[model samples]
Target: MTRALISVFDKTGIVDLARAIANAGIDIISTGATARVLAEAGIAVSGVESVTGFPECFDGRVKTLHPLVHGGILADRRKPDHVAQMKELGVEPIDIVIVNLYPFEETLASGASPDECIEQIDIGGPAMVRAAAKNHASVAVLTSPSQYGDAIVALERGGFTEEERRVLAARAYAHTAAYDAAVANWMTELADEEPQYVGVGLPRTATLRYGENPHQSAWLSADGKGGVANAVQLGGKEMSYNNYRDTDAALRAAYDHLDPTVAIIKHTNPCGIATADTIEQAHASAHACDPVSAYGGVIAANRKVTRAMAEQVKPIFTEVIVAPDYDEDALELLQTKKNLRILKVTPSEEQRDITQISGGFLVQARDQVDQAGDVFAGWDHVAGPEADEQTRNDLEFAWRTVRSVRSNAVLLVKDGASVGVGMGQVNRVDSCRLSVERANTLGVAVESDVDTAGGAQAGTAASEERARGSVAASDAFFPFADGLEVLIEAGVKAVVQPGGSIRDAEVIEAANAAGVTMYFTGVRHFAH
Candidate 1:
């Protein structure tokens, strides 16, 4: 008769599995709690100690580490010498091994004590799993509860094929590998040292239709933490690679504000962002900043989507919209747009930023706005008179919003809304010029006077009028005075930057000459 060894920390569906194995004429041997549970459920099961001829000791840590247990699982049925040795050593061949490691990940997530966490790490379980997987040609190994159903059917039909056994063995190895990665990462965290090797084992959650381009095949793996990966899609077509990228960018920009906010993102750059008392008004203001770019952009709202917001968005062609939730009427209306992907996500704090290069990955702590040490507390008034209350508020909003933009970024903000954004430029001076140009060309007209005969001249005056008194933020310090001069010439009233340049004095002189208030944040935000 075939012998099957079963041991698991998670006992879901174990009783049914044991019954099927017993009916198939396979003797069941279990360890510790698994044995007791199976015996109580009226299944005739033998304790692993009986097979090993040794009592479990060291708080059950040494139970399955005996030579007899491993020899049975590792013996190759096709090898006459191995079968002969096992018979001489009185080691019965075990045809099947079902095992799952202890709950180390769950224990760590529960914020358990260090000693408790260390105790939860399984040693013998992974050893048995690896041994059985190594000799998969003769023995079948099952690691997850999800695999039990198929394993039972195969056992009932005589036994698993070599191909099936190979698949199970591969899964078994991945199971133990993920468990070990969790434990290793936890230990590294406890030791408070930089890890020499980072072992990340995220499960494949989705097989994307394609990558950034249709020709490249791609998939998504997730750590199971809350974010866009786990978001519930309420409506629309399947999300593409670019949709996920732009949606994440929009969500990050929206969540950066405390008040009700909306962000419109294109190509992972914020085309427009605004904060207001209501989400609807915020969307309106953000869209007004650059209505042309907002078309087909991914939008994110910090608050729930209401009917009023839905009505405003219905006219525009949007790719994706992510929010915490949606009102019934709002969801109903948005669902009518069949191709718009609507996602509901719960925002979670991100701990790390990972980037992949040719050979390996680069990991670092996420650059958060709050990590800059109290937004305005470390700022120095380097030039001109102190900003008034309204200008100060705009300065703070502009500073927070600029962090989401790309390197060499410059953002112009008026009344807590981005009027112009220039990013991904080669030089800061060009970025400054682009920002002013967009502010005058794309921004909503503040003056509604008609001068149709002098159309171009009137539009320029109106654009400059809208930009006047707007605050500007740069991702990094001004390398030269020319960049600061561009913003000053565009009627920007106040400016904020990291302020660590060798030409800081020259830039400050330019601000002082123009009578523009300039503050240095002492911390730079450079997003590549």
Candidate 2:
């Protein structure tokens, strides 16, 4: 009779699986808790010691490590010599091995002690799983409770097919691989050492329609703890690849502020970001920054979506809206837009940032803007006179907002809202020019006497007037004085940036000449 060995930390469907195996005339062998549970459920099961002939020692860690248990699972039934050795060793070939590892991740998340966490790591379970998976030609290994249903049907029909066994073997390897990765990462964190080798194992949670384009295939994989990847969709059509990217961008931008804030994102870059006293006011202000670009954009709010906010967004052609939650009236209103994707996302704790390169991955700690409390506390005012309270506040807002923009980024802020944003440029000068142009062309007028002409020169005076007192932020230092000149000429009153460029003296001199207050943060935020 065929025999199956079962051991699992999670006993979700073990009894039902064991009953099916017993009814199929297959003998069941289980370890410690699993055996006790099966016996209590009225299933005739033999302890693993019955086959290994050695009692479990080391607090039950040594039970399944014996050669008898491994030999049975590893033996190749097609090889005459392997079968002969198993017979001579009095080992019964175990056709199925069902095992799941201990809950190391759960233990870590629960704030367990080091000793407790180490004790939860399974040593023998992964060993048995690897052995059975290697000899899948003769043995089938199941690692998840979800796999039990299919395994039971296959066992009831005599046995699993070769293809089925191969698939199970592949899943078994992935299961062990992910478990090992979690353990390794945890140990590295405990030791407080930079890992020489990093392992990442994210399970696929979704299959997207395509990649950045329609022809390329794409899928979404995540750790599933929290964040945009695991956000709950409440309404709208299925999300596409671009939708997830833009929504994540919007969420990050919105959450970076302390007040009620909204960020409108397009192509993973923020078109507008603003913080206000209410969600509705914030959304209106942010949308006013670039009304044309806000169409079909993704919007994220740090606060719950209120009915007033929903009413403001209803008429726009928005692609997605992500927030922590939604008021009943707000959700009901937004759901009317059937094709607009609505997501409820709870922010997860910050994690390491990993990017894939040609040969391998580049892993680094997240460049959090708030890692240092009060980003402006250490800034040096190197040029012009001291800024007024309002100008200083706008400078701080621009500095924080610029961190989320792409490289060669420059942002203009007035009254806690972005007036103009220029990003993804090849040079700082162009970004400066673009930001000034956008401020004059698309930004809301600071005065009522704004020129109404549609041409480039129509609002030249009013555009300069609007930018007169606004503060600007640069993601990095200006390599030359030309970038600063552009902002100063456009009427920017103050600026904030990291100041380590080779031509820092020239840039500072330009600011001083223009009487524009300039502060150096000594830190750069470069988002590629």
Predicted structure 1, TM vs. truth: 0.89
The alpha-carbon lDDT assigned to residue 396 of candidate 2 equals 81
Worst-scoring 10-residue span by lDDT in model 1: 450-459
Off by over 4 Å in 2: 445-465
Q: Please, what are the lDDT tens digits per residue for candidate 1 over residues 212-257?
A: 9999998887665568877899999998888999999999889888
Q: What's the alpha carbon RMSD for model 2?
A: 3.8
TM-score of each prediction: 0.89, 0.93
lDDT of 1 at 385: 92
lDDT of each: 0.87, 0.86
